[model samples]
Target chain A: MFTSKQMHLAQVFLKIFFRDRQSIIFNLLFPLIFMGVFVFFGGESEPINLGLVNNSSNTISQEFSELVEEEPLFNVTKGEESELKRQLFLGDQTAIIIIPESFNSIDETAEIKLLLDASQVRQIGSIKEAISKSLLSIERSLRNTQPMFMIKVEDVKSRPQRYVDFLLPGLLAFMLMNLSIAGSGFNIVEYRRRGILKRLFVTPIKPQDFIISIVVSRIVIVLMQLSVVLGLAILLLDIKIVGSLLSLYGMIVIGSFIFLCLGFSFGSIAKTQEAIRPIVTSFTFPQLILSGVFFPINSLPDMIQPIAHILPLSVIATGLRDIANDGVSLLMINLNTLGLFIWIILSFIVATKFFVWKEVAG
Target chain B: MNIIEVKNLLKTYPLPGNKKDSFNAVDGITFNIRLGEVYGILGPNGAGKTTTLEMLEGLKDINGGSALIDGLDVSNNAFKIKEIIGVQLQANEYFESLNLSELLILFGKLYSNEINTKNLLEKVGLLTKESAKPKELSGGQKQRFSIACALVNNPKVLFLDEPTTGLDPQAKRNLWNLVRELNVGGMTIVLTTHNMEEAESLCDRIAIMDKGKLIAEDTPQGLIDEYASEPIQETLKGNLEDVFLALTDHRLRD
Candidate 1:
């Protein structure tokens, strides 16, 4: 009996899923598109896009041009410092880091000014930081090691974590979870609003069977969608999975059920879409902030960390993070697995009992 | 034996924003329906007819009294009762994607095991529409299809809530004829409606209720003789509809 119901449910989920093309773009594609823009336009690029008109015949000026060419961050061209600065003002090359003929001799005591696009604060900050770091390396390696001045060279190693590598997967998981949990989860509320529950109430159907069928069907869809998004991330962004695929799949299955139950509970209790919108928003926002979907939740206040820990989002996020970062299995993270099931039970109880079927308006 | 029996049925709902106050939607109403008969409950709107039907169907809880169907209590034996009773609600919406055959088969699975919806649809004059979704059909076609769904469980008792509301005269006649045929074939039926003419033509007996109480209950002619000043037809006469109905026996021969 349940198998038949589950089949029917799968059919419903498939029909609804295929029919909705807009949500696919908004929920799935939107995140990847945002990431692409930042990585492309905002990232480090070639040195120059224009001709460098160099009037200086000085050796120091020629040396500076060669140095710029050697630097991967810059596609260096030869031009007078003043002309380069004018290009900076015209929104060219992000910012023109100019060096006068006297720049090579400045390592002894003089400071070199790096021109930045002051209007582009973020790019300017990153550009300035990168240039400053590189200059410090140059100063220590070449200038300080010489007997020209009483300068000491300290070898500093940069342990810069791949910032994009850490963030992109999290962003991908966040999108998948939101689409599965937040979007389709609230669809339960929509079903009630459409009086589908009322229709179900008139049947000889078991509530457990109905709910279980939905859970199964939704889990499959969520998993399928997450796979597609993950595929896009992998193909386009080269996102590598370091964790156990089994564990990742399990966490999502359990997490999807947990959040879907939360969705169901919200749908069941809310009187109208207006009432449900705020209630579900409150439920989901806390999960988003507390679960380390964007930032680490451990950074929250000491007093609030415990509260965050107990949230389904927190446990699911932790489980996902562990699986993603550590490749841990279900046995490796017993507490999270247990916590997820507990939440599923608690939320299902609330949803089953309070989920209103009547078309009561706000 | 009586297929359905109720004694002092009561249902109260908590009045919103009030902890102490409660409103009784079904106020100690009691009735019985024997097997192999069409029993209709008629009333004005807000008269607890739907509420009473909902309770008997186990869609709502009874605040007081006992209800037994086939000697099984309605409350404690909901699943047992549900398995045996087929229900069709007003506007009887199914998932917009489900075809006539699919829905019947689905409901049949809910009741028991695999089912053949072909014969059932044929009986309800919906054989041609087996593959058509509920939304694709007209109101009358949908209602008739709903009746076909209600019979899927091979239910001993069929409960319908205003089965003919929003239906055209021809469709309504078709439904009445179908109901009459079902009763003749020995299936008990319990229905709620505000249409007096429908009750007069199709129902074997009726319970007239108002304000959560049974005000009048008898055969349609008997209730009219007691309360109506004139003959039942004269009391609420239709200019031409009566002639149209009378000329064609209130059954769909086609």
Candidate 2:
């Protein structure tokens, strides 16, 4: 018989949350709230304080200046060459459009020169190309009523994904690792500290059952949170997941177990929260950043790639990206799956070995 | 019959860095607590009273010695022993939001034989406070609730560690009374305490230990007799507490 002991344990688990719903909200829901608030309020920031510096005072300059002024991407500024450079260096000017001091007669290879803040390389590239094309069209239109040669810069009006969609998956990944890590870490430490595991030494309950119950509960809760968020995302935003929902769910659940095992291993040895917290953060933060929670892992150093590629979140994020965007089965991400499995196994071995039931002295 | 049997059992865990440094919290102490008897282990703090109690309760590793409960080795057959013994830990409590009734049902579900929650709650005089959360209850009430939990499994041996250490006088009296009531029902009780009054009033046999060794063991009267203090002078009179109880029907709660 499993006995009411297991049921009592379940009650204990739920009761812990019930006792501190406020703390739970702060710990589990705080990151999500911040993500939502910042995402919604600051969605796709408009290019603030845009400027275009024009050096030449010719008709093309005047016409192009007017065109650039009309576009939302630029707040056209007419200035001397030094003034534009000074503004660009001071972070005041976004870009400078310099028309060479040439005769209006040399209409054949009229090159448009743009001086942009070096920091805005990506923005400058797109903006400069569009401006050059627009100028060509405008220059052509002036000569002929049929517009012999016209260059018009066009900023494509393709709408970007809303901030919520951009952020929710990352938020989910962050929360999953965080909760599983917190739950398993604190629960096991508590077991040792409160002498519960020491007490369980008197029972038939193996350490495995205790560990399994905790990991299973955490994974279930993670899935529950994912399902709710996933359903809401589909209903509210008309977001459609490209990959198999089941595969994503399975990967996430397995990832939670990996984090849980990591937490338990830490918890078993650490007697207090103060002791294991820094260790937990050491594990969580590096994996969080290197796992590419917010950005691409490839952006980091070449040396870090191997380490980053192995984190559970890294693999999960890749799997999620593939599933949600590419519509591929998780098994296709075999190397990543194996990497996470290695992490789970390695953490468990170390943790189980070092875990003392109560105090080492006890 | 002896319910607890222990012999030359020893435990030594290697210290982290040094091969020579080892803590013998209980060292190699040995003793037995018998059936239906109130046995007490008295010691100053850190003298291994708690360690000894834990070992008997199967909460500690029997490093280099053997401890048997009802002929079952404590180290090897913990679960079988757990079914027969109940333990009330010193700092054990709920998550603070669990009501008395909810906690009862939760622990009640842990055993093959469950105690009637209503009856136990009433017996502890917390029947009216069943819906109150653990935090909402006073210190006295919390202790009562804990004892109630220990009894939920209908354990034959009940182990209480410092059960009434921090309670007020009247509350302590109530605990002493409760201990007597449980003993009357044929429960074998072994407890650890530093309070001499508790030992004198509740424990039928008292064992005083120091430096992980049992220095003295005898009945309470016999112990008083051994020390050559007249029995009445050394024991509680049950005087003011009973008088106060008669004058005010309500129990002193906190």
Candidate 3:
């Protein structure tokens, strides 16, 4: 897939990338600065907001609710079942517990339903352990030594929501997106504006070879970027890799290809260096804010969330997060990967269709 | 024997505001160049000299007629023609971070050739400043460097588009010397220029173009004797500039 000419060009591009001060600062240091800001402000721990819906008027159920309210692990909010469910849906509550009507009955096993959002996956073990401990104590107080109640856990598969574990993967995707779009797009436009492309067009160099060179260089840079960001994140933020490193890198390469195609499309369309900035920014800014890079996609307004989910960056972030945080296999994230594949085809077509070697005759 | 053959070459561009209306930029112009000779296309701005060179170099498409370079159809075998031809555009800026030697090597790799960077730089008298980037070189040095890049593949035929347009006298003389040296080494040269002295001193034959049409084609002295034979007040005999003025009826800069 790579020729010697492409390799040579890629090497030169790498040298240029390293020596160019603006490129160094933009591609490498910018992401680190963002990561530092996120860590400084978003690192502080806050008490989890727990919604408690008491369905039973029995004294025992009421007492159990009070016990949950006293627990420091939770900031309990007492509310009606429908109202609390709405809060959970809106991300106001981390989890909700429903105390059934038969809670204090010794003859029956009271099923207490515990509903959690998928974003709170990290806290599941701790939350479940705390609830079980509270129920066991109540069981002891009733003088039935055997287990008297059961907790049924229901996890709402909402958008993969928040914190450093979530933000790190999204940050990785965001960096690759910027590197691909701005790096290739701006560079190609500059080449065209300076007559470099026209000069190359006069040579025996094939167009596909030139494109392959760019792809190789960007993929190499993307790897270096991943290493620096992921290395620092793991060391400084104590982020654990739940999935294979191979899978994570694989997903990142796929994402880099898609965005590079998009960059080429922008490059071909834009005739000058100044004209490229707004075009690239128009595409990247929305994804940066709405693609769940720093925040969850669910936090976006309902109508926008659907659009955000289908964004290239969003799909990449979701894929990387699934692999890195949840230890999900590549196959598990097929839907996200499929979305990226579609983007690859679409952007590739645009890149090729509009590619111009020289200014058209007016 | 002719190395290049052209018949009624044409390049049409649509009128800016109206797609249905159009004008020819290189309107049915025809000329040919013999093997191993320096041929110059002389014209004012927008005479379609560059467009003609571009069409022959396979950089622009042919709209009306056929162009053959070294027996290969230019439109059908653009890449094949590119393999045997070297092109120096009027203006160029190479990769900013790469030095002359590095840029030479990179261009060499594009043709799958192993270039001796020092020898190439020395040929252009830029050996000492080779480690400097393209942006660091002066106007003449950059022009020389651009020529050096065009020579990377050791092409049989070289096309230079206004190679010394913005160069100072010293730089321009240096480039003329370089072009002569390359021609002496048996490479066919084709160039476009607005400088009359450059055309008379460097080119063996000159073709004058005006408003997308070839007006005159002859050797420098032949053109002077045929079109500009009337002795002017300033000099005893006319030069290529007088011939150009007589043929085009306008100054080269205009």
Candidate 4:
């Protein structure tokens, strides 16, 4: 329900946004720079620095430690117990592994102690599982026993979930969310502070018309970011979209709309651009860290897992992955769509209720 | 004929953090602005000049009574009222990176009018800087651009709240000339200012309000004649500032 006037205003917004170098930096270049960094060093680029405090002289333990040193994911460093503990505490190392003196004993029980920072919730579980698997293989080789049991993971979806495939959708979602939240929020606060809204209020333009113009302009920007990130990801990173392209775009559009509403809510709260920054960052940072954007949800801490699953970013990211990487249909993502709609409605209400059209005269 | 009529208009703002204590910013003030004349509301700071202007502009809700613009109730027909009135806010900032021409066109479209951006810029003496962004314009150029934006809708009435508050003397004089030119072109103007000289020279009739109440309303010459009649040391002397000082007590309200 947009009038021609709003559409024209949207065109002006696009002109200004593209012409401003600062806006171009945030809207276009930042996403590309992030994508370039991500593509250059894959998702597992950050090698986990680990310290090995080996007390065991046994050949099995030594062999296991040597095997761990060979993993591409781990950068193993040999150090004394006290020194490694300091490194782990200082966060200079991700984790430290202590192999006890009786680690290779057949008659006595031995334990492998994994000293890790609990705050590194996303990596702790996977790191533990990988170490356990490596040691189990070593124990199996020493015993020279017949094969026991094997576990297999099969992708029930149409496409294989490569690391790039998983990351591409989340990265696209991140870019869209950032553009809508930080981009739209700061713009709203800036206009409000500068009396643009007040001047518009004195004109014949309705509030709805002004908001529609903003949404349409931000949507255009969001689409641009989408194409850039997805194009680079597909062309250079080999991330394939197995689902219908139209369906993927539809999901992205709806997800971006939800964030835009949240942006308005924040814009209503912060009266100036300076105040809006910390407020918006506080809201987006938690979602970025906890909301399965960069890592799988299950790897997070138990208490944080449920909250992360329920966040709007988590739903959007998971939904995009399911449709693009898993070839799922819109109907299959009913819950995610409903959750996002609920958020949109709630945020829209809060935004309109608190929206400051003009500064009140004292 | 009166182009604007206000009747007992009141606006009470709730005291922050205390709903029980509320103060009336504009208390039962009433006045009429004749058609085709510039009306000035002259007051010191915090005298509700802006609050009154906003109420008449249909930007704020009136707690009591009513205001009418061109025979239409402002409270009920605010949207319609907005269509026929141009407003120049004190802080006039538009979308950054848009030159004057582009900004005018966009603003004109908001009112559903096809404005001649170049012609309007030329009329405001901003034709050469039509391509200059708002940030690149000088203070005087920015004020001219703001007035150009206001005129884009072809409004019947123009409301400017402290139009020249932050400008230099040259810019202020330049804006005064623009206001006179616009008024002569048949637009009813309502402006608020604390500068006695501005109100004296630009306004045909001035309403002096203090502490949210109208203290005096008369032509600038009439006010001087009325207030200056009291002989000071066997000599009569009065200016607009003397009239303002004689009427209102010199103290901050709050």
In order, what DockQ does each candidate have?
A: 0.31, 0.31, 0.46, 0.54
lDDT of 4 by residue, B189-238 (tens): 99999988899999999999998888899999889889977655753677
TM-score, model 3, chain B versus true chain B: 0.91
Q: What stretches of model 2 exceed 4 Å from their correct place? A: A1-8, A15-20, A23-45, A52-64, A70-72, A78-92, A95-168, A190-205, A331-333, A340-362, B9-19, B112-115, B229-250
Model 3 interface CAPRI class: acceptable
lDDT of 2 by residue, A61-127 (tens): 6765676666654566766878778888887876677666562443556555666776755556666
Q: How many pairs collide in each candidate, listed in order?
A: 6, 18, 0, 0
Clashing pairs in 3: none
Model 3 chain A TM-score equals: 0.67
TM-score for each model? 0.78, 0.82, 0.79, 0.84
Q: Residues B48-134, candidate 3, lDDT per residue (tens digit)?
A: 999999999888879999998898999899778888999899877888888999999989998899999999999988899889988
Q: How well does model 1 score by local distance difference test?
A: 0.72
In candidate 4, which residue pairs clash?
A: none
lDDT of 3 by residue, A93-172 (tens): 98888988778766678898988877745657876787677656756765547665677865474334337777889989
Q: What C-alpha lDDT does candidate 2 achieve relative to the native structure?
A: 0.72
**Model 2, backbone clash pairs (residues 3+ apart or across chains), number:** 18
Model 3: how far residue B105 lies from native, Å: 0.9
How many steric overlaps does candidate 3 have?
0
- Every candidate's fraction of true contacts kept comes to 0.31, 0.31, 0.83, 0.88
Ordered by TM-score, highest first, the candidates read 4, 2, 3, 1
Cα lDDT tens digits for candidate 2, B44-127: 997788878787776676777888887888877767887788888887656456678877776665554555779989988899
Which prediction has more favorable TM-score, 2 or 3? 2
